[model samples]
Target: MILRSQRPLKLKAAFICDISLETFVSIIKTAYSYFTLLLYIAN
Candidate 1:
């Protein structure tokens, strides 16, 4: 379970390094908001 969760973050980290910091942060924020919305609905 830990590996599963970390795998995406590892991939994202590589991608983030390839892109500009501002865009990478924006992408992370967008994904985080979507995940939060899903959890909100689930709860």
Candidate 2:
């Protein structure tokens, strides 16, 4: 019974990790693009 209850909690934690990772990737991409844009304007 305890094992079954803990299984769902593990799945929830994995799901949250996936979401945060995706968000982090998108933020990095946005920042990189902005950085390039700034360099282009400066040139």
Q: For model 1, how does the per-residue alpha-carbon lDDT over 1-43 read when each residue is reduced to its tens digit?
A: 8878664442246555455567778998999999999999999
Estimate the lDDT of model 1: 0.73
- What TM-score quantifies how close candidate 1 is to the native fold? 0.57
Candidate 2: minimum summed lDDT over ten consecutive residues — where?
7-16
Which pairs of residues clash in candidate 1, taking residues 3 or more apart in a chain or in different chains? none
RMSD of 1: 10.3
Task: Give the Å error, residue 18, model 1.
Answer: 3.5
| Overall lDDT per candidate, in order of appearance | 0.73, 0.68
State candidate 2's TM-score. 0.56
- State each candidate's clash count: 0, 0
Over 1-43, each residue of candidate 2 has an lDDT whose tens digit, in order, gives 9888665332234455533455666778999999999999999
Local lDDT at 21 for model 2: 52
